[model samples]
Target: MGKPTGFLEYKREAPQKKDPFERTKNWQEFQLFMPEDKLRQQGARCMDCAIPFCQAGTTMAGSGEIGCPVYNLIPEWNDLVYRGKWREALDRLHKTNNFPEFTGRVCPAPCEGSCTVALNGDPVTIKSIEYHIVERGFQEGWIQPEPPKTRTGKHVAVVGSGPAGLAAAAQLNKAGHTVTVFERDDRIGGLLTYGIPDVKLANEVVERRVQLLEAEGITFKTEVEIGVDITAEELETSFDAVILATGATKPREVQAPGKELNGIHYAMDFLTANTKSLLNSQLADGEFISAKGKHVIVIGGGDTGADCITTSIRHGAASVIQFDINKQKGAMRSGDNVWPLYPIIHTVEDAHKEAMAVYGKDPRSYMLQTKAFFGNQDGQVTGLQTVEVTTELKNGQKIRTEIPGTERTWKADLILLAIGFTGPEQELLQQLGIETTSRTTVKAPYGKYTTSKPGIFAAGDNRRGQSLVVWAIHEGREAARECDRYLMGSTRLP
Candidate 1:
């Protein structure tokens, strides 16, 4: 420990965010970094426990099953930060996590939940410290492209170009294999570039990493639909090995009346178009969905729902409301949620806070289920019918039952479905003749990235359903190792 009494003397402090109302005016990041001394003090708050659960990366029994899936060296970086060794801190942060910049902004920080100090008091500001370390590295020119010393003469193809695909390509390139990333979209990043809003993660941040990757001898092929543009057989014949990192993007649909209305749209369609238009023309070309002066209703409260709410607010929506089927959680942790696990409690996110500020009230409603959609004469969505639901535990699963008399109607000019995704699209997998699980995900056993067919591997959401970016990176790294082993017999990748 850098200071034995540091945890006792210092309290956790996070970076400040811009005013909610003011920040919603633009699509820029709002977080401001902490001063060096204050950040060091926050780093000092790390307890450096004997068995640091923050980096356990295990699937324990209970709510927060996993901690840092990438197994970040939390204590070592914390101590380095406390000692003002920022360059060393950045080096340590990059050991396991390929993109700390992305996770620092988007990840929910399960590491904090598993922190030993969080049992009694606030956890260390690990995420903020991580962000600063990388940002500082970039500023000081410590981060640069390091090409492989020698080429392996083996070429590998990675499909997707999302977090998983990028990480896999990076590791494979480090192993001296010529790596090419295939992206269906016009841009490089699949989710990071388009799925996530720029207000949380700026395009510049993603572009910087992409530039570095390109400089490091990795090739990115965008607007190339592998199955359609080039046959899977051709791809297999061209490359020594193929890694499928395509994320789970098939959205779960709601079976409700008037589902085909003009104003009713999927969450990805809205988010993707808005981002594309913003980057292409700054919304000047009018190619994106317009929530301006419209009453918006976002279904399924989660991160995607929150993104919709915030995006609608920025578009000058007249009103915004979000719905969740599950009942609202308690303010404090429940009895079953003990220490060192992610607490099941109500928490406010940036979008929620922004919605409250702009709409003058919290825009979320719990225990409400959508029944049907009501449209106007023009066939555009005008309102929605909903019914209140009660949760009843049967056997071990929670069942939601709608109450008959609790039906109601609400005005909704635009409806965005923010429900989660199902699994990856089946066209590419079917074309490759790969097996899948009952859940429709690619049937790759846990830890082993090999698919049913030889020379083909699966990772990320394509293998393990929709998940966090950290887990995607982990899967990509492991899958690259397996792919390397398959090609060269023995591998040196970690």
Candidate 2:
């Protein structure tokens, strides 16, 4: 270890965030980078635990406990950072994570939750250290495209340009296979480029990596739909193997009245158009669903809901409110959810903080479920009715029931449903004759990633259902190895 007893000497320090009031005025990222010395101190907080649970990547049965899904080499990189060997840290980071920058920015950091230090003290700022390491690598010219020395002369078509697709493309290209990525959208990055707001992850960051992938001989074909523009048969015929990294984009619909109203929309649709408009003309084009001067109501209190609330605030929304059916989590973890597991505790995110600063109150409400949307004569949403609900255990199953006489109505000119995605769209999977699980995810063995049909495989959100970007990257890397082995009878890719 670079500093023995460093954990005792230093307290955990995170990057400073720009003031919510000021940062909400624009779409730029608000997180300010910590100084090099402070970052090193943060790295020093990593204890030399005999069993480092931070990198274990374990999923305990029925506990909702998880470690890093990508199995990041946390201790190695933390030591490198503590020693001020950032270039070496970046190399170690890239060994497991193809896109550390993406994960560093958007991932919820389950690694920190499972940190050994987090049992009694604050966890080391692993995510911030990771972000700095990769960003420093790019700035110092330590990161560059490593094109394969010799071509395998085998072509692989990767459908979808999300994290999974990009990771698969990168790994397969490294193995000397000619890889081409197909994206239905005009941009190369699927979720990172569109679904996420610029305030959280800037488009330029995504562009930077896409450019590097291009430099490394990975071809990105944007605006090319697999089932629509090019038939599934064509892809199978043109490539040696096809990997389906298309994300789980089929949004879980809110089965409430007046869902077809004009002002109601899916969360992704609203977010996607906002980002596109922002990038295209700085919102001058007015091509997106504007929340300006509108009373916005977001249903579902996950990351997507948080994004919606923040975006609406940036658009100068009259008011914003987020509703969740689940009971609010406690301020601290319960006894059952002790150390080394992700704590089921309530915490304010950046969006919630900004909303508090702007609206003078937290915008999230628990145990409230939308009953119906009320609309005007023009069919635009005017308001929504919700009822307070309570949960009770019946036969070991938790069930929600509406509370009588607690129905309330609130004005809401705009409604964004952020309830989360159900699974991948069925068109492409059906066209390719690929089997699916009972949950509607593309059927593939746990590690093999092979579909029912030969020469076709699945990975990422499409295979695992909606999950974190880190999990997508993990799936992509693993699936690429499986595909490579299937095609060449052996694969050296890690």
lDDT of 1 by residue, 81-142 (tens): 99999999999999898899999999888888889888888989989999999999999999
Q: What is the lDDT of residue 489 in candidate 2?
A: 97
* Tens-place lDDT digits, model 2, residues 1-494: 78879888999889999999999999999899889999998898898678888888767866765678888999999999989998889989999999999998999999999998887788989999989999999999999888889999999999999999999999999999999999999898999999999999999999999999999999999999999999988989999999999999999988888899999999999999999999999999999999999999999999999999999999999999999889999988898787788888999999999999999999999999889888999998999999999988687687989999999999999999999999999999999999999989999997899999998989999999998899899999999999999989999988
- The lDDT of model 1 is 0.92
Candidate 2's TM-score reads 0.98
Q: Which stretches of candidate 1 lie over 4 Å from their true place?
A: 392-398
How many steric clashes does model 1 contain? Answer: 0
* CA lDDT scores, all candidates in order: 0.92, 0.92
Sequence-dependent TM-score of model 1 = 0.98
lDDT: worst 10-residue window of model 2? 58-67
